[model samples]
Target: MNIQPLFDYIRNHVTLTSEEETFLASKVSYRKYLKGQFVVQQGDVCKYESFVISGCTKTYYVDTEGQEHIVMFSVEEWWTADLGSFITQTPADYNIQCIENTELIMISSDDIEELYIKIPKLERFFRRVIERALAASQKRIIRSFSMSAKDRFLYFREKYPQIEQRIPQYMIASYLGITKEFLSKIKSQIILEQ
Candidate 1:
């Protein structure tokens, strides 16, 4: 795979020496997941931080009733992992699964730590990335609690138009904390009024 795009993405945020970029790239592994495959299951130790090169994934938790509640979705140029498990080296409380067949570049926690020792700037880069992720998650939580179903759907469409096209309706409904039927009604209402 051409790694230039990935390198450029990193370079834009962090100034990595040529040798550091080459070393970091060498440590990464390319992985592919089929639709419905679990990248990390509940109770499993999450070993890798993955960057999506293509396709989409959802991170969710199954409740006692076996209901899936989606926490977040990741599409191209996004990262997906159970950060609680990956950082703490504990078992994950959530499942991360591919919604579409996906290609990813992954680096193990161990390898990333090694990179940090060799190139300390990566630590700063990743810390900023984590901060952004936390902020985004906070915003999502506030929106889910504060917005109506129709408003949530509209917000999702405005923010992540690529996801609206690629993900199935039911999964999107779950992510929006609404029923599939309600989502259909929302869509129809918007179309008719437009």
Candidate 2:
């Protein structure tokens, strides 16, 4: 598969010389996961940072009550990993699983560190990536505290219109911290309003 998309994503944040691009290409590898496969499981060390090339994945945590709370969803052009575990080389607290058959380009933590040393611009690119991710996460936290369930659903729908069609309603509900029944009600109200 062509890796132009990955290159384009990086180039949007940082310019890469031909040699640098070639070196990056060599360090990354691709993998295909079937739906329902776990890319990273809770209690396993997260070894790779992955970029979605096709399909979707969900990063979630399981509570003591055996409920799954989705922390994030990664679709095409998005990145997914348990950053804390990847950085610290510790067991992951969350699980990353394929929601659909997925193609991903992954760089191991060692390779990423090496890339940072060899190509400083990559370090800058990743720093910005992490910053944006953290900012989005902060926004989510604030929204959860300040917004109503319907408002959260609306905001999520506006931000990720494509994702609703790709994932199950229950998963979306989980991500929004709402019950499936409540999400259904929200959808019905939206349809009636429309």
Candidate 3:
């Protein structure tokens, strides 16, 4: 498989030398996950930061009622990790699971720190990534409080149109904090309007 897209993404974000690229690549390992498998589970320390190569994954939390609430979804080229737990070395409050059979490139937290030392630009790269993630999370929170369910659904479709075909309707409902029946109704309405 081509690592060029991933390399290009990093290069666009931060400058790196040939040696640094080789070093970083050496530090990363490829892994595959089957659907229904957990990459990192709740209460487990997140030891690695993973980049999706293919398929879909979701970060979610299980509530007391055993309901899963999706926090985010990662498709090809996206990164998925429990940032808080990874940095703090504490147990994760959420779980990252593969929504489909998936391939990922992962680097351990320690190795990532090593990467920063060897390739200083990577520190800048990750900082920007974190900034974007935080900003996106803030916007999502604002939208959750301000927008109607139908509006949120529409926005989700606009933002990640392929997600509709990849993720189950019930999971999408959970992600939007709506009931599956409500989502179905909204979908039907949207279809009729179209």
Candidate 4:
């Protein structure tokens, strides 16, 4: 499979020589999962940091009451991994499931360490990626506390219009910390305003 997207993504952050790109590509393997398949399960150690070649996956945790709380979603050209579990080699707290049939290029933790040692620029690239993820997470936390449900829904719609089309409404509601019924009402209100 073509890895130009991945190379381009890294190039946006740090320049990579052709040999470095080839070496990076050699360390990763391709895998595919059907919709509803779990890439990483709760209580199982996550072995790979996956880059989405296509489709979508969600990271979530299930409570004792069977409620699923979505932590994040990774669409095409994005990356997904349980950072703590991946780094610590411990059981994952969340499950990563394919929401759509997905293709991924995955590098194991060991391979990643090797890459960092062999190509220092990759370390810098990943640091920027993690920083952006943290900032987005922080912004989401602030929004959940400060923004109204309608405002949050509106913001989500603006930010990820494609996600709304691809995923179920209930999943979107879960991400927004709202009930599906409430989400329906919000959609209706938006339609009425139009």
Candidate 5:
């Protein structure tokens, strides 16, 4: 499978010599998952951190009440993983499942460390990636407290643009921490306002 998109993405973050790129290429593998297949399951240790090559996946957690709460969605060019599990080598609390058939470039945690030594600049790139993820997460937490449900839905639309069309309304509602019916009502209200 072509991994040039990954190389392109990396290039945007840091300079990579051809040899570094070639070595990095040899370190990663590609996997394709059908819709409903899971890349990482709750209670299992997550071994690979994956980058989306195509399609989409949802990162969610199932509560004790058996309710699924969607945390985020990863589409083409996005990355998905249970960062806590991947970084700590512990069991993951979240499940990352394919929403559409998905192809991903995967690197094992061990390989990532090796890449750090061989390509020092790659560590800088990953630091930026993780920091941004953390920042977005912090922003989401703040928004949840500060924004109204309707406003949260609108902001979700603005931030993830067109994501509404790709996943079920219920999943969107879960991400927004609202009931699907409420989300429907919000949509209707927005339509009326427009």
Candidate 6:
């Protein structure tokens, strides 16, 4: 695997020397998943954080009623992991399934610790990534509470236009917390207004 995308993303957050970059690459494992394969299943311990080199995956939870609620989607250049499980080494509540044949550069929790000690700059990169993720999560929570479903859908479309085309409509509806029929109505209304 080229893994250049991971290096490019890291560079955007923190400057790394060539040696540091090479070392980081050595520590990560490259893996590929076919469509519909699970990266992390609920009740399993999430051992590594995966950075998407190509393709898309959805992080979801299957509720007691057996309905799958999508928490988020990870596309090219994004990272996916069960954060709580990966951090604490506990069973994950979320399942990460590939929507397309995906290539990932994954680093285990133990490898992350070693990287932090050897190359402190990597710690800064990871910290910044987590901080931004936390902020975005908080904002999404607020949006869920404040925005109308249609508005929320519109915002999602604007934010993830690329994602909208890659996944099925039903999955998109699940992510938006709306029914597929409702999403159709929303789309129809938007089209009529245009």
> Candidate 2's residue-wise lDDT over 90-147, tens digit each?
9999999999999999999999999999999999999999999999999999999999
Give lDDT: candidate 5, residue 153.
96
Candidate 6 lDDT tens digits, 99-151? 99999999999999999999998998899889989999999999999999999
RMSD versus native structure for model 6:
0.7
Candidate rank order under lDDT = 2, 6, 5, 4, 3, 1
Worst 10 contiguous positions by lDDT, candidate 5: 156-165
Local distance difference test, candidate 1: 0.90
Error of 2 at 62 (Å): 0.5
- Please, what is the whole-model Cα lDDT of each candidate in the order they appear? 0.90, 0.96, 0.91, 0.92, 0.95, 0.95
* Superposed model 2: Cα runs more than 4 Å off: none
Give per-residue CA lDDT, model 4, range 85-193, as digits (tens).
Answer: 9989999999999999999989899999999999998988888888998899999999999999999999999999878889999999999999999999999999999
TM-score of 6: 0.98
Q: Residue 154 in candidate 3 has what lDDT?
A: 94
Residue runs of model 6 more than 4 Å from their true location after superposition: none
lDDT by residue (1-194, candidate 1, tens digit) is 65665777788799888889889888898888999999999999999998888889999999999999998999887889999999988999999999999988888999999988988999898898899999999999999889999999999999999889998899999998888999999999999989
Instruction: Report the lDDT of model 3 for residue 37.
Output: 95
Residue 14 CA error for candidate 3 (Å)? 2.1
List residue ranges in candidate 5 displaced over 4 A. none
| Global Cα lDDT for candidate 4 | 0.92
TM-score of each: 0.96, 0.98, 0.96, 0.97, 0.99, 0.98
